[model samples]
Target: MTSEKLDRRKKYTRMVLKDSLLKLLKQKTFSSITVKEICELADINRSTFYAHYQDPFQLLETIEDEIIADMRKYLHTYNLQEKEDALRMTEKLIQYFSAKHEELQILLNKSGELSFERKVRHVAEQFMMNKMTSEEKNTHLPEYVSKFIISGSIEVLKIGYLRDVRNHQKKWRS
Candidate 1:
């Protein structure tokens, strides 16, 4: 096969694996999932799965890393210098979540099996820390204080996300 065709096949296989994994996550914990099951779902060979990821957990972590990288790009695209910028960022985030609702549903589920919540919190923490660093304030707050505030903000987003999902379900049902 040509290099371009091989790359396309690789991309297709990886996407199938990841999408199957996310669908499985909605039904069960990641720890309970197996590489065999993932390959079965994706209709790929076990050897093919091993070529891309050591196991299911590795695939989960890879997806989380991709999410964080996309979020970082979103953060970089905005100036985020003022409160207005923050609000605008929030809107953009909500839109992003809405578009990726099913995938986010699996990732953001309050399951103890994955550290996705922490990964997202880390992104928010990093964004806040960068914002604070860019501004010249009278007095600098400790990192812990900033982290605490970011945690609170994340909680708010969680609540908003749940509410948004609920409303969407209602509209779908009706």
Candidate 2:
């Protein structure tokens, strides 16, 4: 096949694999998923799956990246400098999680199998970096201080989600 056709095929295969993986995720945790199961679900060969991902975890990473990109789009107003602006961003985040509560639950459950906390922390750090001055960005906050701020916010939202699952209580939390 021509390179162009090969690229198209690869894209199609990746799309198929992604769709199948998402379907499986609704019923099972990420750790229980296997390459063979995904290939069977996608009706593709194991080699094709390997061509796109080294393992199922790589596919999970891709899924998380897509979700984060979508969240970033939804949170285009995220600016940590202005408290009001951050409140709006927090509302948007709460909305996003409420809409995807099932998926987020799977990712945030206490099974210690979840990686979304790290992903959320990374997102928070990125938001901070984007809002800070060059000097502040260069001066790294101590790790504990960093976690104390970001992780504390995330944990509040994480638990608060179980309550109303919408309407972020930024005033109370912040």
Candidate 3:
């Protein structure tokens, strides 16, 4: 295949793999999913799956990367110089999570693994780090603070979801 054709084929394969994983994630936890399942859902061969990803977890990482990339792209287009901007971004993120409650409940709450939380926290921290000014980065906040904030927020959200408190806008506001 020509270079362009090969690139196109690779893109198509990744798309297939992503679609397959998303479909499966709707049905089962990431931990329960297998290479055979992915290949079967993707309608691709084992070798092709292996050629792209070592496992489903690796594919999940790619999906997380793409998600963060899109988030960063939006952040880049904005003026992150104000505290309100950051707060709004966080609110937007919460709304995004609210929209994906079903998918997240399956992948995060049901999966019996902390990988989803870790990925979410990682992305949140990276987003904050990218937005911070050099002076802010230097003082007042330690590097671990971002992790703390992300994890704490996630824990709060998880609790809210578990208690069916997510539906109460007033409770969430408090």
Candidate 4:
């Protein structure tokens, strides 16, 4: 029971810290963010922050790692060879993006780091390569093709999301 309680407390501390960092990312780039600011925003002590992360950059990297891991899990759930499965996977991916919209927006747009975006593309590319049919793998073209498609799709999602956010803001202000 004591161990469980400690686990819960640790989870809560990490949650608040993640939230605080993301909230700060909205106002400034990750490079400009400080450990002190994150702790103050989280209402957590700087020592506690250091206990969990080396710095704000590490915390951000942790967040990115979690996102990529989740994406990998999602990608692995479907056999992408079948048309129906592929369609279902795409739908699920969009749903995942919708669920993570705010966090993604901050990371993809606000963080001012291409690293996260590149990591996302790399994960997707790896998933595609692993799922490709033997025949498809024989041709080197699929590798390049998959990279192009994944990168374009991610860019389109980013642009479309930003446009939707702007439209929503306009509606809210009117």
Candidate 5:
């Protein structure tokens, strides 16, 4: 096969594996999920899984890494100094979260993993810190304040997103 075809095959294999793992996470904790189960769900061989990832945990880590990278990209895309730009940046982030709701809900709430959530909070905190003026940083208060704000913002985002999803489902049912 050509290199392009080979790369496409590899990408498809990884996508299915990641999707299978996320689906399984919705049903049970990550620790209870097995490589065999992932392969079975993915309809790919165990060898294929190992070719991409060592185990389920590594697969989960890969998913989390991708999410963090995307979040960082969104954060760095805007100049946060202007209030209008800050609001637009927030809207972009919200749109991203909404688009990835299922995957994020599974990772953040159902995966029984704290590390992924912490990584998200860290990313937000770092972005906030980076946007702060030098004088603000010199106060030593901005660090603590930013941490508090970022932590609260993340918790609100998670809770609010879940609530919004549940509300939508209810409306659809009715």
Candidate 6:
């Protein structure tokens, strides 16, 4: 096959594997998922699965890393200093999750391996730390303020996106 066709085929195969893993994650924890199961669900052999990823955790990490990278690009591409920046960021998040709703919902469902949720929390914390006033070193106002607002905003986005996905699924079912 041509190089273009081969690359397309590889991409398609990776999507299938990731989708299969996501589907499995919805039913059970990441730790419970096996390479065999993923391969079976993906309709590929163990070797094929191994070729792309060493194990389930590796696959999950790969997917989460890609998602987190995309998220950072989306959220940090513009500075969030004003109220409208928050609004724009929220809308962008909604759009991002909506486009990959099902896949995101599953991978983000409390993966037992690595906590992307905690990663997001750390990111928010770092952003808050950067925004802290240098003169108010003793106040710690940034920590307090960001803990309440940014963390809450992240939670709201997660809950809202998941709820919207569930509602969409329901709409499709009925």
- Model 2 per-residue lDDT tens digits across residues 1-174: 245555788888998898788778768876788899999999999998987898988887787787777666655655533544444444555565667665555555535655666777777555544554557556665334555656655665556454463454455666
> Residue 69 of model 4: what lDDT?
86
Q: Over the stretch 1-174, how does candidate 3's per-residue lDDT look in tens digits?
A: 245446888998899998888888877777788999888988899899999888888998787666656555554554355654456656555555566555454455544667666766666666666667788788857466666656666666665473354467557687
TM-scores of the candidates in the order shown: 0.70, 0.59, 0.59, 0.76, 0.76, 0.67
TM-score of 5: 0.76
**lDDT comparing candidate 2 with the true structure:** 0.66
TM-score result, candidate 2: 0.59
| Candidate 3 wrong stretches, greater than 4 Å | 1-6, 79-87, 95-106, 125-174
Ranking by TM-score, best first?
Answer: 5, 4, 1, 6, 3, 2
Q: Report the Cα RMSD per candidate.
A: 5.8, 5.9, 5.3, 6.0, 5.6, 6.6
**Model 5 residue 71 distance off true place after TM-score fit, in angstroms:** 1.1
- The regions of model 2 sitting more than 4 angstroms off are 1-8, 77-86, 125-174
Per-residue lDDT tens digits for candidate 5, residues 1-174, read: 245546888999999999999999878888888999999999998999989898888888899999988888877776454533333444445555666667776788853458988888787767666766678778988678666765655665566464474447447545
Residue 105 of model 5 has an lDDT of 67
Total clashing pairs for each candidate: 0, 0, 0, 0, 0, 0
Residue 136, model 3, lDDT: 76
Candidates arranged by lDDT, highest first: 4, 5, 1, 3, 6, 2
lDDT of 4 by residue, 16-129 (tens): 999999999889877888889999999999999989998887898899899988888877776444543343444455555656777776788853478989888787777666
Model 3 compared with the native: what TM-score? 0.59
Candidate 2 shows a clash count of 0
Tell me the whole-model lDDT of each prediction, alpha carbons only: 0.69, 0.66, 0.68, 0.75, 0.74, 0.66
- Judge candidate 4 at residue 151 and give its lDDT: 66
